[model samples]
Target: MDASHHPCGGIPSRLPGGGGAPRPDARGWPKGCPSTVARERIRVPEATRRVKPAAACIVRHNYYPDTHVRRDAEALVEAGYDVSVVSLRRPGQAAREALCGVNVYRLPMQHRRGSSLRYAWEYTLFLFLAFLTVTALHVKKRFRVVEVDNMPDILVLSALVPRLLGVRVILYVFDNMPELLAYLRGWSARHPVVRFLAFLERLSARFADRVIVTQEMPRRAMASRGVPRHKIAVVLNSADETAFVPSAAPDAGRRDVFQIVSHGVILERYGVQVLIEALPSIAAQVPGVEVQVFGEGEYRRALEEQARRNGTTQLVSFRGFAPFDELIATLARADVGYVGMLNDLVLPNKLMEYVALGVPVTASRWPTFLHYFPDEAVAYFRPGDPEDLAAAIVRMHRNPASSRARARRAKELYQDYRWSVQREVYLGVYSELLNGVVGASAMGSRVGAAPYQRS
Candidate 1:
């Protein structure tokens, strides 16, 4: 297969070609990096891979290298499934390429989260384009499964043809879109836009043969809307113990300055703004305190402006993204790793990353976070409260021995959520869906040929 250009959209392909190791760009946040997991996150040679491939088509609106979607694709491939990712294309990325062992096709469209109408256009446009692309790919070689990772939520509807051919459709929802938009935009649950989003979300769940949510809250939320319990899978965003090999570290006593680290897209709902608010208070209590933020987003520029406005730019630094190994090493060396998001329902990916690296952690205190992370495992602070977060940081600073002990406890608890342990659940769900176990009325919701038979 000549996987070099987009299958559709006559927009004459443009490419800066392959992705080299990340170097500082003008904005300084690894600007041109093509994907998050650049074969650095997964590796399985063709000679060693299983001969029989359970063919799969995975779709997402995000970049091809999104950690969660990439991890899921890697898991499917590891379980003898041939996986192909349909993802968005940025400036520097090629329209098509292979990462690790999974084939990827990038569509010629990109959308940033914004207004209600803007989201509507972007989602509808991508849905039409992706539907055409997947249909064409399906004719080339049949796929037994189509998995859609959500943001718009209803992208699974793009698998119309395959679903007609009896291919199972799985809705792999990473975050609850309605709740996320509500929090980000400060919209009430009963608001028109929020209710509309909730309706779309329900449509997406109803359209899928199986729904995979990152945490228990979403699963229960879906169940409350009448989706069967068995149809929903609770797959937390846990670290893979085998994949992350921690680097050697020095004693905390040797460091004179108190350093804190946070990474990933600097979104407003993540409450990184709260981190900015806490900096002055933290500096007052501990003069040498510095917060190193890696990764970039529109919110990052806002954060930098906020730091300048507060005259605390010296206390915060935007270090930008590094190669996977170096990024982990940076966190492993930090005194404290923080997950300061405003929402409590979703699991913080960075929290798991912090736990895996055995880094002393301080995170927003919420029922959802505490459900998975116990009090002894991680220090907590009130979400959206700068004073509380600063106090949490100071507590960790004053008692290094206690925090280290908590990190050790967290690491032991994280063992169960590893990809090694969790992959089986994903496979089991796919296996059931493939066997024609329509836990819900997927066929009726689908606009395809009558019902499919048991394979």
Candidate 2:
């Protein structure tokens, strides 16, 4: 009794609308009876007929609560795509969870600072784990796109399986690895290690269907280094305005203590030591001036010791790693926000956060900062010079009216780089990539018309 040869098998011969059984046809079955193949071709239920959303995955070595990754993932979720993030997991965090509509799968590894070999081992482990995780997820969820955020650049290779399956791949370059390595290790660009990093970067960029950079500087850097201009898109690291809005309180600016705040990873290259060194002079000029440092990193102990040596330990408080809401409240109440990075290659997100919150900024006069912020919008100080920073802080304290004006100007300038505006640009990049129209000329046209001016 093979079902294929049975006239009706288990299926009913009569249609739903009939009042009586239908008459048999020449084949000795009811007229208009559906054949086995026709039965299999019945219409799907209306509820199940809707199109399934395309799936997207973000692969980064960092842990969750990463502002950039979270922002991008949530944006994709909002755009009706099913988004998943594969990232490092810290102790006490769940291995898998849904956050703000984005599914996050945390690997059982934590990032640690260490020597070159140690870093290599860690990256390799994460790369292998990522490769396995993405491949498995794609088999189940069928990811249409995979985006890899790079530190080693070659992490983009983890998506090889997905790319081979015709999934679009994106390489999001947060830092130029070669330039950063050269800057951190005092290596020349022509050094063998630096050249190797550059080669890896080019390979990663070529492997990816598209490359995304934080700003114009990196976009140009990648292009000049032989990355196809059309393959690159500029999506800035602007502050999320909803979380960094100006305080509505009338007394938000009326602080009894003149507090200066700097928040982010405390790295020497970021020049937090410069701010601490300038504290004594700043306190001398502006009485009761308090410097609040909110963040934690390898440089925290060095900065603390520097503060003690400068005899301004009492004035500078190390409030390490406050929650995002707390950080925003502190920024709102602060009299001035500080960004003291030592190089032009780094564009500090804290600068944009300060501006987004309408806090007057005192930042290093690096090319990257200057390109985005005009002199009138920020009180500029020379890089690594405590004396100049002290003067800049003193000037802000002495002329509150002028500082307020600069803050207003900074807020106006921030309108151009606010996440609200940049989110669309980011989504457009995805749209282009998914549509298979992402090209050098198309990317160039979009970037050229973007709010940020070219460097």
> Can you give the lDDT of residue 77 in candidate 2?
64
CA lDDT, every model vs. true structure: 0.72, 0.75
Runs of candidate 2 exceeding 4 Å displacement = 1-49, 246-256, 323-325, 439-455
Query: Which prediction has the highest TM-score against the true structure?
Result: 2
| Candidate 1 residue lDDT tens string, 365-388 | 888778778899999998899999
Q: Score residue 75 of candidate 2 by CA lDDT.
A: 71
Best candidate according to lDDT: 2
Q: For candidate 2, what is the TM-score?
A: 0.84
TM-score of each: 0.83, 0.84
Judge candidate 1 at residue 176 and give its lDDT.
76
